[model samples]
Target: MMFEENPPSSYLTRAAHSEDSQETITAISHVLRDQEDTQLVPADDSESFAAPGDLPANPTSPQQRLAKLKLLMTQQKAEYESKIARLEQRNRELQWEIRDTQWQLGQQRQRHRLAEMKIRNAERAKEDAERRNEMLQKEMEEFFETFGEINGWK
Candidate 1:
């Protein structure tokens, strides 16, 4: 007997005896009847279903597309975070450099002020030494004149 498109005669006869063949035939008939009674209902026209061609044409299902987009976003976010971290590190280095530069400038200015003070002090000392030398020269010249006058009287 035929069950759906398959003939049960071949499977039933393959068994050892007539009783076994009858039992096999009965089981196959029951399965076929159950399948026929519980037929799968088709989807409505408004409802969308994934066709076999759809996945190959689109290259991604809706869930897979969302996951891919999320992955790309996460990668971009990580890159941006790394860039920001690098920039922050560079900014800190620049701040340190600026502080060092300012310290150098202050030290140079201090040295310049000290040099100017030393120059002013040297100028004052030179002026005082010149005044003392002029006074000593005048005193020596007067003593020589008095001594010459005294010697002439002899």
Candidate 2:
């Protein structure tokens, strides 16, 4: 038998006889009788009507079984192919994400290196400014010593 996602509507279990109202049954029967191809099989009459020898031979002979099996295999193959396609798409998405993450990480590393260089340059400039200030202070002191006597109490 072929695998099915859902039972056919006709094969589904109906409400119990106690749950079915007479009006519902009458309405259903009327609708069914109106249909040209609808045959409401009597629940117990068919067994009594046909003798053992009168019944048809096994409908699912080897050839029919083989055909059904082939159909089932085809359906299974289609389902597998669909699943594989979806999984392949997912894998491609994951690979893209990985590459994006790597690119972002590389950008961050570049930014970090640039920041460190900026910090080093600023520190070197600060040290140079400090040395210039010290030299200027010594010059000012020497000028004061040499010119204080000329300008005032010599």
Candidate 3:
């Protein structure tokens, strides 16, 4: 389901401020740090190197710094792409779970309907048996009375 169609406000707020989101941000920062540390930049290429806590004052060579920026952007792009892929896979899993729950609900409803039908049938059978028993009891009483009358015992 698309979240934008009928998104819950609480869900959006929770997602934005979630621990997982914060961890992902922290991980991306670490990745950027690691990449920067691993790259070997020559000391003579001072145009691309920015001093710690100091902004690059030289605007003479923009191309070198532009190349470094492009590289960093590419790495971050890859990290974000992988994260998106994982989130998509999780979405699919959740959809399947919802479908399974719905199927179980349908099956339970069918069983409940069947149970109700059986109960009604049982009630009808009980009523029929009680009626027959009353008819048989009346006939027995009449037979005993007739026999008693013919034998002159009454």
Candidate 4:
């Protein structure tokens, strides 16, 4: 039956000559043209759109071929999106790891500085103690010398 002869009660009709119908038909034609223009070409035997000689001998109708191309395109898109997401997630993790490493390095450097300061302080303390010990030794020697001279004169 002609599409208009048994027009489904639910179908809405507009004058064919109306501007709206013309616009609608134009839009539909554009879509169809786009679909036709984007015909897939197979590059290798593994591709879904490969010709029969380039692919397995399994028979496939034109409808099946189109369906296969569409499915392949969808699968490729999903795979690409998934890979991008994973890479982004990995980048975030690496960035966090780098920040943590930098923080630890800073802490280690501070500890090293504190250790160096302690060593310097210890060296100074040792030098002061040595000087005091030498002074005490010289005073003791002078005292003994004086005592010996007095005894000898007596």
User: Candidate 4 on 28-53: residue-level lDDT in tens?
Assistant: 34433432454323333332343334
- lDDT on C-alpha atoms for all candidate structures: 0.57, 0.53, 0.56, 0.56
lDDT of 3 at 46: 33
User: 30-148 in candidate 2: lDDT tens per residue?
Assistant: 43332213222222212122223333455332322333444355456656777998999999999999999999999999999999999999999999999999999999889897788
Higher-scoring candidate on lDDT, 1 or 2: 1
Give model 4's TM-score versus the native structure. Answer: 0.55
TM-score of 3: 0.57
Instruction: Report the poorest 10 consecutive residues by lDDT, candidate 3.
Output: 1-10
Candidate order by TM-score, decreasing, is 1, 3, 4, 2
Clashing pairs for model 3 are none
Candidate 2, superposed: residue stretches over 4 Å from native? 1-66, 152-154
The runs of at least 3 residues in candidate 3 whose Cα sits more than 4 Å from the true structure, single-residue gaps closed, are: 1-61
Better by TM-score, candidate 4 or 1:
1
Off by over 4 Å in 4: 1-58, 61-63, 150-154
Best by TM-score: 1
Q: What are the C-alpha RMSDs, in order, of all predicted structures?
A: 22.1, 13.6, 15.4, 13.8
Q: Which ten residues in a row have the lowest lDDT in candidate 4?
A: 1-10
